[model samples]
Target chain A: MDVIQIVVIGLIATVLIVVVKTQRPELALLLSVAAGIILFLLVLGKIGSIIDIVRDLADRAGIGSIYLGTILKIIGIAYIAEFGAQICRDAGEGAVATKIEFASKILIMVLAVPIVVAVLDALLKLVP
Target chain B: MEAIRSLVQNLIVIIILAMLLEMFLPAGEMRKYVKMVMGLLIIVAVVQAVGELVRWDYRDEIPPLTEKNNEAELSGIMAAASRITGNQEQKALEQYKSGLSKQVRALVHLHKETPVLEVDVKVQSGRNEPDYGQLKEIILFVAGETSSGKESEGAVKEGVEPVTVQIGSTIETDEHIENRDSPAGAAEADLISMVANFYNLSTEQVKIIYR
Candidate 1:
């Protein structure tokens, strides 16, 4: 698969979605969602090595992986929330999408508390 | 990094294909639910990918089930089973062959004249059936078991190494007693009598067919 191939794919999908939307709006949404999911899965396999690289970098920095783990979780929450929000918006559920975004932000905030506390504690120690 | 790049490329291709396929699917009333499910699936996948990116295999922390599968354990069990069954099968085969050898000892005189070869017994058994009580059926095939062509001593030394044979089981009958004057007929008569006497059954009760 190359740029041209992806462009071809995008062209095909765009045409199909356009044709489907006019005949069946629901099917168009389903098509778009399915495409999004498939794209996500394809990118998933790529992420494993990226994770390895990040872990390697953290190890080099003499940082505990616990904080890095938390950060990863927060990142996941944010990404998922945005994804859900987008899907909801596409499905014409603005309120539901907004709620999803709100929930994701809260979850991410909660997840970051430990890191934030540690950072603050370190700053206070430096001041003292 | 190159692998990841290729993966992303493939993913784009897959997305396009999925779009084409989903476009053709029936737009059911649960469109919102369908979208939610798809989005959730992607999100979970992404989370898993991201978790794996940091090599955070949290699954190792989870407790195993009582009967979780272990490859080494399973292989050992399988090997032990195969060894046991192999021994049992060999034993059963020898027992059957010896039984046939004894029953046809009188027919040794007949083997010299007739096309009668030694009986080969193969027992088909299920996995758990060690004693072979669940043995479905026994196949009896006879091939070049005659030791007449080779040196008699050499034949004894060669031994029976379980070669493939496809012939069916054959039984001698007394119905042709009227033709007992001929050598083949006489051999048949003797065979029927010997087998019937051994099994304590009338010759009429036994059924034998050749393939």
Candidate 2:
């Protein structure tokens, strides 16, 4: 998006948030959520470029597509977790945010298990 | 037909999304969430409709400024200028040349350097006529004065007959042209400058028509 378009959207979001805060607190939270999602959509093209670079790097390093995909999945999990956590915090739910972060870390570990196992196997084979 | 189909599809998708969100939300909050989603959907629909209307209108309204058209509009302004200044054809020509320079300067002040494609002037002869030219002149004077760091004192000369000018933009059909509407304040000012020069009046006296 051009800077003007982004600024316009931001201004509209700010206005909606302000209006909602005064008249309806719950609606304000919803407006903020919508704004965040819209902003995310605007930057999605850049995110895709980042993912493409990471995929190319993994391929050149001979890490295999499966390994790269796992890493990407972990990254996606982290991002979604953080996003949800922030939304919860904005809604005044600190406990929900902490739980979200905890769950994300555990999920990341779970996704990394296969890569860790493969590395261990390679090392054992070299010893033999 | 295809656009209508796509629009129907979008509406359906929005309705489904709203319903899903309503299901997830608490019973008390569902109504508010649903209403907000509906409002957003309505905004999207209105924006889409307006965009389509503009696209259709622009397709018909935007026309290329041919050399013949350009000459005709220029000569018309020249005729009007000559009549107002009580100058002969040759004197009008001299006035046009000097005015062209002023016009170029005004454009440059607006940070524009493109060749002018065409110029058209419309004058209100009767007192009952709306002073569109005056309004246009004021807009241009304000824009030029602000951008060029020049005072309005000499921008428009007095005793010059007031005439309205409509500057039709050059139509770009080439892929590289990247055509867009004139900048925030420059177009109005440029038109005024052109009319002022054509009629031997100051920029302040020349009016621009914008709509």
Question: Any runs in candidate 1 off by more than 4 Å, and if so which?
Answer: A2-6, B1-211
The candidate maximizing TM-score is 1
List the per-model TM-score of the A chain.
Answer: 0.89, 0.84
- Tens digits of lDDT, candidate 2, B48-162: 4434544554546665346578889999999998787654644554465556546545554553532333333333323345752222222232222233322222233223343
Candidate 2 per-residue lDDT, tens place, A1-128, comes to 46677789889998989988988889999998898788879878876776676555434333357765665565566667777887798889999998987887677667766765665555443331
lDDT of 1 by residue, B48-145 (tens): 33334333223344444533567668889999999998898778766775675555544444544434344432333444567552222222222343
Reference-based lDDT, residue B121, model 1: 27
Best-performing candidate as measured by DockQ: 1
lDDT of 1 at B5: 55
TM-score of each: 0.37, 0.35
